[model samples]
Target: MKKLLFGAAPLSSRAADVTWLLFRLHLGLSIAIGAGWSKLVNLTTATEAEKMVGGAGSPPDWFVQQVADLGFTLPSAYFWAVLAVWGEFAGGLLVALGLGTRLAAFQLAVQFLVIAFFWYDKPEPLLGMYYQQLLFWAFVLVTGVGGGRYSADYWIWKRATARLNPPAARAATLPAIPVAG
Candidate 1:
């Protein structure tokens, strides 16, 4: 679990790392700001226009009903709707920051998996499923790769390991070289 949470990026080429970083930034921001921030703010400041699109002060009656339609019992439906909203908002933010990335990506993977497979009566089934599947796979990729060397996980790991094996300690452990006579 610690490894999963704090692992560095794979030891691939610099290009690979850079590419991963770019992908991470794009997907993370898309999920965080594009999809999450609005709904999160809607939790307290949903406008009438927002209401029509499933945003309201409390997870939107329409959204809760949709959750219920997914076979969740009412009240419980409310609970689940709220959880999903929070997950999108917080999970996206964590992913964007590359902090606790694997866990956040895993949660998002589960959410997108459900959205792709379980969402009912999608307006454009193929198109919608494509989008959800793309997101699901992208999140799965992040979960597998973890936060790379450029991520907060790497920074934290470096700090923790440095404390455990400081430079002075390392120098002390090394044998001195013999002088040439």
Candidate 2:
């Protein structure tokens, strides 16, 4: 069983690498534009947002109130919203490009935590937010594992290390030349 699970196998091909890259790109862009970007734009003019859930007539009736309950003060509400939105927007782009992916993922994970906590008062549809939470956890895992073989970071690190140590590259390329009599 162990051998079946951990047996030596050939690495994936370049095509597979490109496919994975495209998958990450699609995932990142969709999450950024569809989910994060709207939040960012809304944060710019969120005073009107207080009307969506309820007006200032009641304290615990609006979305902003929930945010306040989560420890965001009056002015800090805007700041926290902006931070959360930008973290998702910019971090999604970084994850898409596979640049600083781990850091980006970490930021996004924190944003998810904040959003989840703030929304504790009025929970959305389970199918809607559940997948987002799952995605955040996946991002956290990838943050620890890095962007893998399909990432720009991998290639950049390889090139940088190679440039810093030319002898290592040469040694890596050296072949076992057969001696002839």
Q: Tell me, by lDDT, which candidate is best.
A: 1
* Residue lDDT tens for model 2, 1-181: 3221111221277776676677668767876765566454443343655444532122222444555667778677756655665666778887888777777777877777556534566656455478667776767765665655677677676666567779877888899789998
lDDT of 2: 0.62
What's the residue-level lDDT of 59 in candidate 2?
21
Q: Which digits, one per residue and each the tens of the lDDT, describe model 1 over residues 30-87? A: 8875566666555434453544355433565777788899999997999988888778
In model 2, state the lDDT of residue 34.
Answer: 53
* Residue 22 displacement (Å), model 2: 3.1
TM-score of 1: 0.82
TM-score, cand. 2: 0.65
**RMSD to the native, candidate 1?**
4.1
TM-score versus the correct structure, for each prediction = 0.82, 0.65
Backbone clashes under 3 angstroms, per model: 0, 0
